[model samples]
Target chain A: MKIYIPNSAFLGNIDPFLRGFDPSDPGTLEITANEKWIAVHPAVLSMITALGLTVKPENISCRKLEARSRHYLVRMGLFRTLGISSDISIMEHEPAGRFIPITRIRTSEELSNFKNEMIPLLHLEPEQSRTIGYIVSELAWNVLEHSGSEHGAVLCAQYYKKSNSIRIGIADTGIGIRASINNSYSAETDLEALRLALKPGITGTTRREGGTEQNAGAGLFFIKSIAGINRDFFVIYSGDALYKLLKSPAARPRLHADPFDDRHSRAEGLPRWSGTVVGADITLDQTAGFSALLDAIRVTYRDAVRERLKARYRKPRFI
Target chain B: MRTIRLVEKTGAFAENKDVARALRVDELMPALERGEEVALDFTGVDAATQSFVHALISEALRRFGGGVLDRLLFKSCNEPVRKIIGIVTEYMQEGLAPGE
Candidate 1:
């Protein structure tokens, strides 16, 4: 099938994704397939699905990114997408999969509902839930505030037992991370904006009504921390440039590596991407310290959100 | 477009002589009956004194009835001035008075 994945696919057709190269522009695929179809990576299938394409798991095409490939960094902790010709396998496609499309409009009330209703279903501890919910809110805020589109975005999360992993994706056609940040830092050159976004305190939030710094420059950083805690793999694609936190720093935390080591080549062994459509993904094993990490974050957020509400409402003092 | 000339001005929309929130919408009902391309230009007009875009658009759409809302247009929308118009138009369907 001539499936049309989003031009933002985390690791879809790569040759054209490199900067200065338009995503719609085509490039030769290294693999030529027929018969049982191409054995593709799980990342490709997901990117396709996010674009609102329909592909049977059985037709999953497999292609591998070289360890040195830019897309390679995003492959952290994620299991390869396996073909499922029949539903008979122990792994079943989630029933809610098709209903959740990328780029859906959501209200603030719905955001609250996600925190209250779905968090429990995920069975994560309090802190885990808090951090997850916060991350979810950040993603929602990013879409509502930045996506130029009317419908913002809809998040689709699924759990696959076969590999004991959860895959979550957030997609939007908004001004994208690159465009929005560029607008914020008009002084910086294009390359400079990309580098600045990687730093800890450079969040690009100025238009927020009250302008809370706690949230302003911290979304990406917090999201990255959560991923690290989960020991999950991640991909961040924005403005013809993609950065993959492939291996969770936790698994092989970035402690020993020399940040100053400029031996040779661009971004040694890290994931790379080149696309304007913005988003990222992560894969983590349940065994990692996810349970404790999530618990701590959830409790912290639970207290914070609770306290904020209490202060705002004042307990409706009874005479 | 069903236009409302607000009787007074306030926080956001002020200075516009042609339209304001407290306008006699009843007076504009007949103009809409003519069913012509309507454009609300806030020229020489300052900010809208009161928030009437939502109510006005809702009523105009209802009076003009079918196939005309999209044809209605606006010009010179400042951020707040524009916000009222956007809130009304963007959520037009949802913002419709419940049963109406």
Candidate 2:
């Protein structure tokens, strides 16, 4: 079987790989570049590789894979890691930024060692190192908490020293934000799910699951706030919703629904991303100290935290 | 008089499970039994999450009441680490039962 990746606005076009996949089939698989110019999200690439890994096929190869762009380089690394290689110069091409290859965090050991692992890769100072550390920690924790993907979560990050910025991406082939939130409350649209997920106390974790004490549904909330305060760009794409928060001095965090298409009507025009991708791009120069960033969050949301705690503790444990 | 080095127990980026494993309640009972104040040293830890902070300190708060927080001193916490410990500790104190 051969899968062709397109050079489109986004890799939302790559969902067809999950179709008709057979675990026991021994068929050889090939992934190729379908267009002259190709760019893909690490989340989509991770999902494709994960699908190929799951079907347990005889062999996998990348044919005519182009490593022109930085994104493609990372995807090449991912393909290489999955034992897929092409007889092309793509392997020799270096990605534009210092890209951390896609990582799989399944065990507690991997998750705990994330900071130590990424620090040298990031080559960040103690302060900037701690900033990304907290960000990635919260993101990884969310994957373990909500993403029901059996294969675990995939993470990729790129540091652009020249631009003084870092972009970190984490995705899981699990139930996306819509399903996770709609399980508790009725979120009729993907945009609604994305919106609700940003609320301070709106967590998908339930009372019976020991969520009250462990989760305050503040992970994304904190991420959103920190990105905004730092004047950075943050994007959360899950299910059919693609919410991007571009940092502006006077901007309020708002979900700009896709004006081109409405999510509720099933007459599909664009393909939907299968999993959750939380991508952040923060400019290092404008970034505050990691501790001050967290402190700002605490001070800003202290009232919100108090309200959530009151609601959580007021309920009886078993009733 | 008993000081637990957080870096020795957990690495720079400490998780909740790691924090729990590093400083189990049973491990601290001996120090408390000897009437020694248990101080958690954060000399080498770079960052901590709220959940990790809560997991590490909640047991102590439960065993010795909110006042036990006073006996437990955090040493050499960086600004971010201190903020995490402070936020979690404050919330835990408020959520405790009236006497606690």
Candidate 3:
């Protein structure tokens, strides 16, 4: 399920009948505002506000105040209403504020136009913006590759100007994460598929170049680095298993690896996975080197085109 | 319609001296002179400095004179992208709220 269900009503305070996990014991399971909504459906993006939020884009404010679990959606709608260009970044009162809403558009042209319009809003430094763009470009392309059945996906973003943080979301009405994972490796369970995805080269594409780049897997790796330093977080859901990355040491790679050319066997464990809708939450930790982040992203803007190049040529000679 | 692009990729999100020149007179003057619908694309694009992106967007909207443009749309975006949009817009409305 998405972090949010569009048109969420009922004030979202109702207790939900959770599966797999129990929510009764507060001591055992710490329920944040997010957890409460996730219990109903993992895809819920929660917004906390005492009063209904007012969304301003360039001009007209929403005449009627409306509340949403995800303020991000409302944010975009207001942007559309006010007729702001894509180059503008929306700011929250605090570095991290809430209540966003976005409408799901149903066309590839529309998708392309929206992305082009919204890319400038990250409020990222020139460098950091590149990295964030790399992340967005990679994920957005994946949806096109994996979800060809659908015209395209709807994406929305939120940037915490104060926290110096941003989160980008892309969702499509196509195959979920499990199927994508299943296409790549022999994973009997959706959870297993999720685990395999976290590994460096477990891709479904038959050709080396065609598959998601090993370096591309590094996309998550680098995002993790930023989130780790800054205490940011990311999540991905595909198929049935929902995977949310907690920006902690357990989820990251060590500084050095033992160069196991032997390829004897993989590590003892992989990221835990379950069936989930495919979406990711990438949050930058507060302390990450903004320059490093920007530098890394800049290189991507210049070189990330390699992923696109790989798509051409039947042999897929290079990646 | 005014087109807004997420410029985190490169090229001033496509803003330039020509745009500055255009802005010196009226922000939309350049786009209008071209007889084009303003459109912004986030395709293969990335983040922009928040203030930078906001300022550009507001200026573009201002040029539209409240309704000359058809519509401003954000394309092929992700959740993180959506979140950033929310933060900026909410901030703008804060000061102008009727109660405030």
Q: Give the residue spans of candidate 2 off by over 4 A.
A: A1-34, A39-44, A50-52, A57-63, A70-76, A90-97, A178-193, A206-216, A251-274, A308-319, B21-36, B58-66, B94-100
Instruction: Pick the winner on lDDT between candidates 2 and 3.
Output: 2
Docking outcome class, model 3: incorrect
- Candidate 1 lDDT over A130-168, as tens digits, reads 344555556665555555544345454444445455455
How many backbone overlaps does candidate 1 show? 39
Model 2 over residues A16-81: C-alpha lDDT tens digits?
A: 432322223336556666446766555445555654554444477666555455345444366565
Pairs in clash, predicted candidate 2 = none
Q: Candidate 3's error at A177, in angstroms?
A: 2.3
User: Candidate 3 residues A1-319, lDDT tens each?
Assistant: 1112233221122112112222122122111223222212112322111001112232222222233333443344523522333332446662333313343434433434554565554545555555555555545545555555343544555655555556555555455555765665567755555555544323455323213211123333334334443444444444444444443444322221111211111221222212222333444444444554434333332232343344452683686
Q: Which runs in model 1 stand beyond 4 Å of their true positions?
A: A1-103, A116-128, A187-192, A206-215, A248-319, B1-100
Docking class of 2: acceptable
